[model samples]
Target chain A: MRRFSAYEWVRTAVTIGIALALGYLVLVFTVDDPNGAFKWFLWGPLSRMRRIVELIDYTIPLIFAGLAVSIVFQAEIFNIGAEGQLFMGAVGATFAALYFPQIPVIHVILVAAFAMLVGGAWASIPAYMKAKWNASELVSSLMMNYVAFFLGLYFINYHMRDLKAGYLVSYKFPETAWLPRILKRYNLHAGVFIAVGFVFLVWFFLYRTRFGYEIRMMGFNKNFAMFSGIKVNNVVLYAQIVSGMVAGLAGAVELMGLYKRFVWQVSPGYGFDGIIVALLARNNPLLVLPAAFLVGYFRTGAYVMSRMTGIAPEIVTTLQAVIILLITAEAFLEFWKRRKIIREAMKAEGGDVQ
Target chain B: MNEIARSILSAEFVYSVIRVSTPLIFAVMGALLSEIAGVINIALEGMMLMAAFWGVIVSAFTGSAWLGMLAGLASAVLLALALAYFHLNLRTNLILAGIALNLFASGATVFLLYLISGDKGSSASIKSYVLPRVDIPLLKDIPFFGDALSGHHILTYLAFAAVVFVQYLIYRTPLGLRLRAVGENPEAAESVGISVRRVRYIALVLSGLMAGFGGVFLSMGYVSWFARDMTSGRGFIALAAQALGGKTAIGGMLGAMLFGLAEALSYTFQAIRIPSEFTNMMPFVFTLIALAVYARSVIARHRKAPSSSQPLEENTET
Candidate 1:
């Protein structure tokens, strides 16, 4: 009992081992050629430079969403409204892009910035209430996600709907308003750099600054922080608002960088995925890089997998749900079981001090 | 202003309230039981979605809406078992476990839909039995209230019955005491020879059963078919009702009715030429405002005198 038991490590190994086995089973059952499908699922994305660049492009919004969720989670707020915020941000940017299409190129940045502002403001409503009134953010934020969805649909159907086009979508956004592709050959936009910069900024804010320290303290024990004279409410509110801003910007990036027009019927659940990413990263900003990549890779591969194997693209979603369940459960149960055995052994040994 | 006042007071508005409140009643009651037993069951959305799907699927097979209701309950109980066991025994994060269940339910239901119908959007094409409406002959004798009570689905009456049932169960029964004790103070409950773990498992199972009925009501009672994620945000709204009601059965019911009213108005407002989307956001917007107002009142109360079982600490401990 003194040493780390072999059983504990085996459990950890088994969880991951089972996850891989499930993935392989899915591929084998779903695909026409299981052997070839295995290679595509694991290694196909790494085959070419363009595919790698495409991976970065796909990873951009996910990274921002991950960082956003991580920031809020650090303050112990579960902002399930990430999808809602992102949708609003996209709506804000879409309106700006459509109406102010004649504005200068530099002014478009302001529009994009305003989209972030609006998105953050939208999320702030829930955060403010949760901080002040002891409201459940998980509930309010999730409800807001639907509110965002229907509102976005309304905008596209009425205000931004292109009469020229037969579909219920906005008019084509002017090229000037479209974010510049950093690589001419690829769709990789300036959003990648922006995502990376935010990652560093978040890491610095969380680990280095007093505000970050306050957030972590509040997250760990709100009463302890309150007793220590930290404004627990303000810290939680700030974390949620800032998280909303990052997620909001991700929406703007997705709208401007990838689309010719706003066509989303609902937020693509990026914010929901962000929760899983944040959990996998253990709420560490720097750790979000690998976490986001794994998610983005699976997402990118899922499309190809579906095309190649006839498996639905949502298989990755199942993988994500399993991974989060594993991570969240692992630490607590291990601690509880180990602590129980220790107490029993100590009682048997007369409970002497070391 | 006069038109707005007229719209607000219309009979259509009352009808809307009844329509929306029906699902919220199921959801809030489900949330109330589990929350009282120390498990935060946020998987209401997933449970509702699965129940809705199963309800439609089962009705299509059996040609009986009652069987569909039973199927929905069965599906939810299975989910409850997974969530309850994992949270209680494995000491997993209940919220995350709820999230996992929700994710799994959403994907698994959709996958099953593909397997059954080969269509992705909805199961409308499948021949499904609709839940029969219950016309109360005597209740219709009463004036304004009778109209509200008459020609409602069976589940609607069941929802009202559930509120009274839950109230009695929690406030008057021994099982209720054990459930509340586990939630209020688990360590103390354990010390008193009550199985805290067992209480939570029972609460979750019951919560799932209630939520399952809610889901069946959606497809069989209301729509007669399951669309993808058609439970939509009702489950979350129910969670909001639980919060607003302060986890009490009556409070939860009142909060749910209010939300239902807001939702009903949102639809009614659409008839009066108001943009449907803006009206749809009414309940959520109201929830935010209510939350803010509630927060201010709590702070005001705190200033007067600190309450025992502080908000931050009461729910924080595992």
Candidate 2:
């Protein structure tokens, strides 16, 4: 309920402002033409219609990733298994596309359900460990990611390798499985609608549902929730499984909507980006849209900047790091802000009743 | 098949295990110190990255491996100070701060690399000075021991020595006593006039120094150049090793060795024509299985000994 306090908003804004300023300083010291490069980074993505479309297309997957992270983060479990879960989800989608070439509209739904199950199954590995043994899910989940990656690679190399392609890529998805394109030249697909629909769905589920309340209560205080008759283990397990399904859905949509075939050599790194997105959104599903939009803007602008300037686009990573550090730093400007607030309150109550 | 079996049993395999473990050992020492002092530093990866990048660049310019090593340590120490300032002073979440630092280090290293060398992948153009290898006279003359223990990077010897050094520092010294006291009961330690923040800062700094050595070794000893994400997941693995060791310095070293053995086995598997992907996943799978088993046994023990579980519950509460 106090999620959007005025003080918190002030701190968040200041954090982002400082991060951007420092990012410009980095560019100024590195590049020969700093102002020119800055201009390109700030406005390049919005300059052309095609780049804008690309940004929208890119944001669709990011929204799902952010929502994925937001759900589990709300449950107080730090799970980086989304990366691995995404890989499995994509693998499941590929299996569906290659094998189930019969149904028309139903094939898309089948692929999604299968991908969701695969992703949930992958995430349950770390969840089961944490629930059963009190193991730190952070390390186990990260380790599980590598296992998923290698297993996925094994599948691609041995099971689904198309020899005619001359690369480690799987067979193409049937036409029936394709999400109808919104534009002929651009990549605007129905996945955008799906991504937006999920934002609302997650919002409703997290706030309006009994299970969600239990998950949040457990996250707030495990001992308190356990005393209140909540099943702590089940909440922990289901939260992560639900989060993985969102991430898995993102993987499926991104792969089918963008690429002609499944050719990911490594985890697409959307999982890590999702952490940044969730942090930016303050773990609010409703805020995921704008948070993901901002990241998509940065990624697109960075690509354009890298092409025009010699500077690497990894500058955005540094920028986001500063943002995270300052945003989460509780005492960063707290003393000053508190003093000013007290001053205002006293001034307004000079002739106060005791 | 016979040749594969023979190669796996050779002294070279043992040598490779120690060689590969050098970085992890250094990192585990750092992880153990921070963890023992009640600070969770997941930024070892970032510290290593900054150190490795600075080590290579400074050595190339200064022509002294020692100076390069100092520069590396200094950079890591600086990073440690920032983390301490953010977490201890600013009240930032320790884990989140560590994650940010990792991203910062990864991005900043690449950004700086481009500025310095006009390249984004590696600092290969820099003629970085590699630290000299050390060979003890007596050990070098021995048959199997010579092959397995001699002629390693100087930092490799330092890593083993560091294990003993940290073991003594943690269990024998007055400072170590204060550190443990603060970690166990910060309020009680503060009542006794111990500064919890100061002790934690020192712990972070020392761990940074240890992690710095690991990073420096990566660039200046194991290889002659800095590459992107070269430390990979070794930093996280070090944290796992520390936890597995029951948070003791010696136990942490043994845990690191187990992981190192797994890594060495993976490398050997590649020689026998196994799918590299399958073999590459072995260490991670081993870590997961090992961690789960360890966690389960610890839980079972706590259930059996109800009195002992109090401290653990208190540990979780904080």
Task: Identify the candidate with maximal DockQ.
Answer: 2
lDDT values of the candidates?
0.80, 0.87
Please give each candidate's TM-score.
Answer: 0.89, 0.96
* Candidate 2, B159-208: lDDT as tens digits: 99999999999899998997788777899999999999999999999999
Model 2 scores a TM of 0.96
Q: Which ranges of candidate 1 are over 4 A from the true structure?
A: A1-17, A23-53, A99-105, A331-354, B1-16, B140-146, B308-313, B316-318
> lDDT of candidate 2 vs native?
0.87
DockQ of each: 0.45, 0.68
List, residue by residue over B42-140, the lDDT tens digit for candidate 1.
888888888999989988998888888889889988888888877777767888888888988887777677657767678977999888888898887
lDDT of 1 by residue, A178-200 (tens): 88788888778888878888899
Pairs of colliding residues, candidate 2: none
Top TM-score hit: 2
Candidate 1 docking class: acceptable
